[model samples]
Target: MHIENADLNLLKALDVLLEERHVSRAAARFHLSQSAMSRTLTRLRETFGDELLVRTTRGYELTPRARAIRQELEFILPRLRAMVRGGDFDPATSTDAIRVNCTDYAISILGPGLLPHVFERAPNLSLTIEPLSPRTYDEIEHGRVDLALSPVQPPAGLRWQPLFEEDYVGVVAADHPLTADRLTLDEIREFPRVSVVVLPQEQMVIDRRLAELGVAQRSGLRVPYFEAAFTALPGTRLIALVPRRLVEARRADHSVRLVEAPTELAAPFPYGMVWHPRLNSDPAHVWVRSKVGEVAAGLRPGTP
Candidate 1:
């Protein structure tokens, strides 16, 4: 390889070839005829001085050298693609709409600050807030959604930027007796509870912690939003384990008092934003992510 003689376009073809490991399938992926893809594969073999794909008992398999190239390509291709497509984005003049998928909990804490901050800087950009649903992962992977916020770790193949850590606090009616002192895990377990199950296994962290101590959230009310848990707490003995920030924000609005959760149960968990790697170096996306990071930084995770 000399740069001047090499056809840079074949890099993408080679990537698809190594990934698909079958000439016809790789050709289909690149929208080229089978014969054309075969020629491209020949060129790749000649350029690299190796048989990139070898016939196996089952089907085509990547040669060791091809495997090494595939590994490097995965890291290189996305950046190259982003660089080619990320042409001189100006946030103030750009009309890009960024869709964020998150729970109402995220909206309650992050929306108030994030919304205005983004608008102030990127005046022409549109921000769309959508609720996190079962289809969220698929939406983000396919670029239907630009960003997602969650405390749970993102599945592999996505990028995570930790925003803040959230600790759980027990909330009850202002006059509830549990507020008088630090409640034990057993005491907390004895009371009826309002559980926020925003997504499947959203409670796993708290649940796992409690389970280690031989306790569980007492069965009472189950709601889909964190706000619902707050509203459900007043005028009742329902003890809810909610984010400390939620209590700080709405305690005045509701007749609720925050009580110290057991030291063992008050472990703080990380909350953050996740996005696809294709947008890693995209200018407009980078601007939007930076603003989100700024807003998250200002939150300054605090103790109850």
Candidate 2:
């Protein structure tokens, strides 16, 4: 029979059928009905021009041709599988680079910890983080970017894995006059604000929620990064709502303190890794994403 016209799936069925020496047992292995497996066995006999399985007084037995084919498949199948499936991945010696797109605030929170964690395991692999933009998902789809950190829900045909939920906390200078354990919405509006606007009309969820409650802050300054928002708050009554993890991670760099956010504004938002489904099973991708999961888990205890 011509190889091009043959159904290669029968080869696998032949292998199992030869080993089992019973049609029903072989059918069970593949979860196929006995009638369906019998049809497959008939097709196999026609393809090879041999009765691959013959009935004896006691049970079924393999003919000479079937035994010879079985021996050949034992040698060929493993190599064929190896050729189809590539070699295993080893991160310690890998030089592959993974590109990630994320906001500066996300970098401020995850970068310091993620870098060290990745380096400790991979050492040779490189990580490139580009600023998140409207084209971020397009870049990922086209194979330019490997992952993205986002709170925005992804569109269809993409995959997301939640890393952690981050709370919004009020940040002010350590010596600001509005020194209260928790400030009311009216009190927060009284102070000038340092707003972080990474994209056009990109308001944080906290701000949107506040506006829904008829509260708005007076912006004394607008910056592009979360770190800048903290830096602009010192020696002034300017206040900002930023991620609590970001404030705690970079607190030593600036003289800023965290104030408890009001219950209305305390709703936490999820930050997750978004990636194209194409790389969902790639070994190297799977390994690095696990490392990322480890780093994110360390940020907040008991994260799954």
Best by TM-score: 1
Q: Write the per-residue lDDT of candidate 1 for residues 24-93, one digit (tens) a residue.
A: 9999989999999999999999998899999999999999899988866754654565466567876667
lDDT of each: 0.81, 0.80
In candidate 1, stretches whose alpha carbon ends up further than 4 angstroms from where it belongs are: 1-85, 201-204
User: What is the lDDT, from 0 to 100, of the residue 36 in candidate 2?
Assistant: 94
Show the colliding residue pairs in model 1.
none
Q: What is candidate 2's lDDT per residue for 100-181, written digit by digit as tens?
A: 8888877777778878867877898767888877788887776678889888767888999999988778888888888787
The whole-model C-alpha lDDT of candidate 1 against the native structure comes to: 0.81
Task: Kindly give the stretch of ten consecutive residues in candidate 1 with the minimal lDDT sum.
Answer: 74-83
Cα RMSD for candidates in order: 10.2, 18.4
What value of lDDT does candidate 2 attain over all alpha carbons? 0.80
